[model samples]
Target: MLVDVRNFHITGKEFERRLDEVQITVNKNSVPNDTEKPFVTSGIRVGTPSATSRGFKEPEMAKIARWMGEAARDFDGSAAQVKAEVNALCEAFPIYQ
Candidate 1:
C-alpha cells in the first residue's frame, strides 16, 4: 500500500497519465480466522513496469500472485516451493546476470 511512483513521472498528475501504474499487483495474503481485523490483510502488485518488460501477462501475474499468497499462508512449506518456482522461472527467462 505504501509505494513511491516518482520514477514514473514528475508530478502527481503526470503519474496519473499512466493508468496502469496504479494497477500493479503484489503477492501476499493473510486471514485471522475471519476475525474482526481488516479483511484486507494481504497485498499484491502485478502491474509494475518490470513485469511488462518481463512479458508477464495478467494471467501470469495472477498465477504468481496466487503462489505468493500460498507461500505467505504457509511460510515454511510454501516458501520453499515458491523459491523453487521462482528459480525455475528465472532460469528459463533470465533478465539479468
Candidate 2:
C-alpha cells in the first residue's frame, strides 16, 4: 500500500504530526525515492508479499492491518507489544530452512 501525502495538502508541520501516528514497519521516502521524480514526497509504502509468501493467512493479515491502522491513526510508541506479536507470528511460520 502507498499513501500519497501530496494529495492531503498538508504542510510540513502537519506531515510531521501525521508521521507520529504510525509505528508500522513501513518505508517512508521522498518523491525521488518513490519513482526518481524531482518532487519531494511525503508518502508511505507498505508491503506484505513477503509475509504472505511466508504463509501468513487472512487472520494474520487482518491482525497486521489492524496494527497498521492503529499505528497510522494515533500511534503512542507502544508498538513494541505489536512487534512482539508479529515476531511470534512469523516464528510460527518460517520461510527458510
Candidate 3:
C-alpha cells in the first residue's frame, strides 16, 4: 500500500519516521524527477507480507493502517497510543507458534 503524505502536510520521510516511532515499518520512496533524482517523496510504501504471514486479516490490517495515519497526523500526540495498539496486535498474532 502506498500512503501519500501530501495530504498529511509532511514529507514521506517524516511520515515514515513517525510510523517507525510507533513500531510500524515502511519505506520512503518517490517518483524520480527528470534527472532521476528523488528530490522529494510524497508517499510511503507499506508492505504486508509479514503481517499476512502473522495471520493479520483485513480488520487487523485496517486497524494498523488507521494507526499509521494517526501517527502521521499527530505523532507527538499519538505515538504512545499507536505503539500500544501495535504491541497488542502483535501479541495477539505471534510470529512463531
Candidate 4:
C-alpha cells in the first residue's frame, strides 16, 4: 500500500538496478506493521513502459497489475501464472517481428 506510485515511471529492471536508491526512499518512510511487524516494504513497484512500448494493451496491463498486486500479497502461484501469461501475450504481439 505504501508503494511509491511514482516508481511506476521506473521499469522493473531499472528498479532492481537502482534498488539502493529506491530502497533509501522506501526505508525512509516505510514503517513496521504493528501486528505482523515484518520488514515493512513500500509494496510492489511495476511499470508498463516496456510492455506498452511493445504494443501490449491496457487489458493486459490490468492483468499484469493484478498479478503484481497478488504476488505482492503472497498469493501462491501468482508470479508463475503472470509470467506465463506475459509470455503468451508477448508471443501473440510479437514485438520484434
Candidate 5:
C-alpha cells in the first residue's frame, strides 16, 4: 500500500518486490470525521442478553476483529479488499442466526 516489500517479512529491496502482486478490493474505512474512528468498537461482549443479533459468541468477537487486522497487514493499498474478505469469513461463521 505505502512502502514496498519483497516477501512476506523480508528486508530491503527484495522484500519490497513481493508487493508487486496485483491488488483487489475487499473493504474500506471511512472517517466521515474523526471521532467515529475512536469509538467504532465499544459494545456488547456476550452481545447483550436480548437483541436481534445472532451467532455471536463473545469469545470470538475479538478473534473476528483480529482476522481483519491480519488481512489488512497482508494487503496495504488493498486493505479494504482484504478486510471485506475477513468480513465474509465472519458472516460464514454460523452465528447470525
Candidate 6:
C-alpha cells in the first residue's frame, strides 16, 4: 500500500519516523506533485513480504495495514496503543525462537 502523507499534512520522512516508532518498517517514496519538481517524496511504500515470511496471514496483514493507517492518521494520539499492539503481534510470532 502506498500511504500518501500529503493529506496527513506531513512529509514522507515524518511518516516513516512515526512508523519506525511503532516498529513498522517502510520506505519513503517520491510521488507526483503539482510543483515544478517532477516528483516529491510525500508517500511511503508499505510491503508485507517480511511479515509473510514470518508467518503472518491475511488477517494479520490486514491488522498491520490498519495499524499503519491509524499511525499515519494520528501518531501522537495512537502511538502507545499501536506500539503495544505491534509488540504483541511480534511476540506472538517471533522472528527467532
- For all candidates in order, the CA lDDT equals 0.43, 0.58, 0.82, 0.45, 0.36, 0.82
- Cα RMSD of all models vs. native, in order, equals 13.2, 5.9, 2.5, 9.3, 12.5, 2.5
Backbone clashes in model 1: 8
List model 2 lDDT by residue over 1-97, tens digit each.
6655555554223443443443235555454344424233466555778877888888988887776554444445645665666678777888895
Candidate 3, after superposition: displacement of residue 75 in Å? Answer: 1.1
- So what's the TM-score on candidate 4? 0.49
Residue 13 miss distance in model 3 (angstroms) = 0.5
Total clashing pairs in model 3: 0
Q: Write the per-residue lDDT of candidate 4 for residues 12-57, one digit (tens) a residue.
A: 3332333332211112123233221224333334445667677877
Off by over 4 Å in 3: 31-40
Candidate 5: TM-score? 0.30
lDDT of 2 at 94: 87
Deviation in Å, model 1, residue 4 alpha carbon: 17
Best by TM-score: 3
Candidate 5 Cα lDDT to native: 0.36
Ranking by lDDT: 6, 3, 2, 4, 1, 5
lDDT per residue as tens, model 6, 2-84: 76678878778788889999999998877666221223478888887889778999899989989988997888899999999
Better of 2 and 6 by TM-score: 6
Candidate 6 structure lDDT: 0.82
TM-score of each: 0.47, 0.56, 0.88, 0.49, 0.30, 0.83
Q: Check candidate 4 and list the clashing pairs.
A: none
Q: Where is the poorest 10-residue window by lDDT in model 1?
A: 15-24
**Residue 50 lDDT in model 4?**
64
What local lDDT score does residue 76 receive in model 2, on the 0 to 100 scale?
Answer: 59
